[model samples]
Target: MLSMHYIQKGLLFKKPPPPNNQKDFIDNLLENLKQSISLALFHFYPLSGRLVTRKTQDPPTYSVFVDCSNDNPGARFIYATLDATIYDILSPVDHPPVVESLFDLDRAINHDGHTMPLLSIQVTELVDGVFLGCSMNHCIGDGTSFWNFFNVWSEIFQAREKGRDAVVSHQPFHNRWFLEGCGPLINLPFKHHDEFTSRFEAPKLRERFFHFSAESIAKLKAKANEEANTNEISSFQSISAFLWRSVTRARGLAHDQKVSCKLAINNRPRIKPPLPKEYFGNSVDVVSTETTVGELLENDLGWAAWKVHTLVVNHDDTEVREMYEKWLESPIVYQLGRHFDPFSMVMSSSPRFNMYGNEFGMGKAVAVLSGYANKFNGNVTAYEGYEGGGSMVLAVSLLPDVMGALELDEDFMNVISVANFANMP
Candidate 1:
């Protein structure tokens, strides 16, 4: 588990009409959701538990084990109603709504071990829709675990509405010791971890949502493959490459300034034998590719894309296993925090998360937002757009000046669709 971090996700769904004999739609929805969450918690019991730190070791460690006893403090769940419509968030604007404003402030996950809740849910009913805000302690799980819980909760709600038993296709595997055999026992210094986390404190940056239509993505892929002189490029590689170049240009760095792009790669599939679909925890490695700002921007887009692709391709199962072994031996895992050098961009989240498929018996999610962008600058969280058809939404946070420059880049804006507030403010 990645301690000291919170994965906050907001999902918006269209409000369904009141069922037969139900007077209030929002009240019925809230009741149903609360009941579903309670049912889901029976399976994901750890989320209802608190963190227990073991300080007896040379380096302290923490574990979030299930505690269903009477004294156990359960996960926090809040229900509220918002006066605004979903358009107040999804409509095109100079800046997207602060991700924090979408949820209840008191219910957010606290990083402090003493008061942190493993999971917090706030369902806010909007004028025309409903917003489901989830704040989960990263120490208990990652985005994968968070979404898995959400899907399961939604399934339970849908099943109850249909008067049927929900079938849980995959049950969560909570054995953190499963990876012990992959590497040597290494002590993690709590102080060092705290210091590393402190470096990611909220920066003075603006977050904007950029939509890339299917056609734009196609153009990017085509250009990247054509430039790389190979058809081996993937959509992730292509978009990453394009963003890397554009962001570098936006920073307007000197020719001698070096720039790097760090991508969060899911290590679950890369591991030998592969982790089970239900294996939930922090299983991500930040892999990076570097180049001079001049070279990155001056070269063809495909060139940068190729570099990104190679970085991912080189991290095969063997390399991943070796990394695990090395991580096990190291006293501290220093994640790529805010870089002090020549500029760097870190991208997290993936279009493969199926952000739009979370249907809670109401329709699919019309919009998805992440609150993490408020804490980390140069952070770009990607999601599968509701429009589908290979569309993507990039929730980007960067320094104001750099974002200004990025919006002005003609080459970068060529394929962007202005219909969805993607144009400059």
Candidate 2:
């Protein structure tokens, strides 16, 4: 329940092919959306519930859980209209501030789930298209579970429009698999929730979406493996390594300054008697690696990629158990303000999720974007390119000057564009 703020992400659909009877069109769409979400909740009802935090006397700790009883306030639904067009959102190289308005519960920390709805849906109407924004509590589940809900919600929406039953191949598995103490009454190390669970503003920064074509990614992978003298590096590792160095160098950090890379590793398949793929809960484990800025910059792409590859590949069952056990000993909830070093970077989400497939009978989504909850400097969120086939779009958040430098950095820009690396300057 520590690291998850409401995951604010959604799809953009071009205004329903000529969008006739604008008023009726939007009214019907909103009606269907609310109904579809209600049906989806029947299966994923835990989302309709609220979080309950109480103080424990014997252990002098805190106990937190989801209250799924009649107290469940159900998911929140909102309807809004924008004076702008979809082009205003997608045309710019950098993310505009207006994008945040698409989703409800702005900057609401998950701890507010005690009274706030666990999930919020806002359908923002635009002249050129429509945006479906979903904000789900991170404390209840990780991205896997969240996306599953997204897909299912769309599935139900499609079925209702067709007047047919939704045929989902695999429904969400609500049973949580745990090797440690997770409970209706598990004790936390804190005496009050307010200590670490309050509101604060994130640093002002420039966030942009940088696209990498399939061919460019392959080059990065091949180059990393070749330079490292081994073929063990994966695409994610290579790209992360390349970007880490690129961003660090752009910032012009001191050579000896320490910087870190953190990524959320799904622990479902990593555990003994591995948990089911459809399990709907928090099975994510964050793993990190650190090195001096000089080492990262001076090292070959292959060397940096291999360093990350080793960190992810070698984390076996033993590591998972040990990490969990260690957390139980000294549990500390995070504060709202600056949570990491000025130079630390964390990459989340992936190019693997079926983000573009969310077609609610309106056609395929044209783009994907996130909310403003966790937008701190050095935070990077990734999504699959709308025109699939191994392409990637990384939404990078960095200080204003640093972002400008990265855009101008010739080496970085080469890998960013759609063209292959060989067509260099």
In candidate 2, stretches whose alpha carbon ends up further than 4 angstroms from where it belongs are 2-4, 58-61, 180-184, 336-338, 418-425
Q: Which regions in candidate 1 have their CA more than 4 angstroms from the true location?
A: 1-4, 17-23, 57-70, 95-98, 104-110, 177-186, 190-200, 333-342, 372-375, 418-425
Q: After superposition, how far is residue 367 of candidate 2 from its true place, in Å?
A: 0.6
Which number leads on TM-score?
A: 2
By lDDT, the best candidate is 2
For 45-160, candidate 1 gives per-residue lDDT tens digits of 87887654334454455332334455767888888766877667667444455446665433233344346567788887777777899887776677777778887887889898
Q: Model 2, poorest ten-residue lDDT window?
A: 416-425
What is candidate 1's CA lDDT for residue 373?
Answer: 25
How much does each candidate deviate from the true structure in C-alpha RMSD?
3.6, 3.4
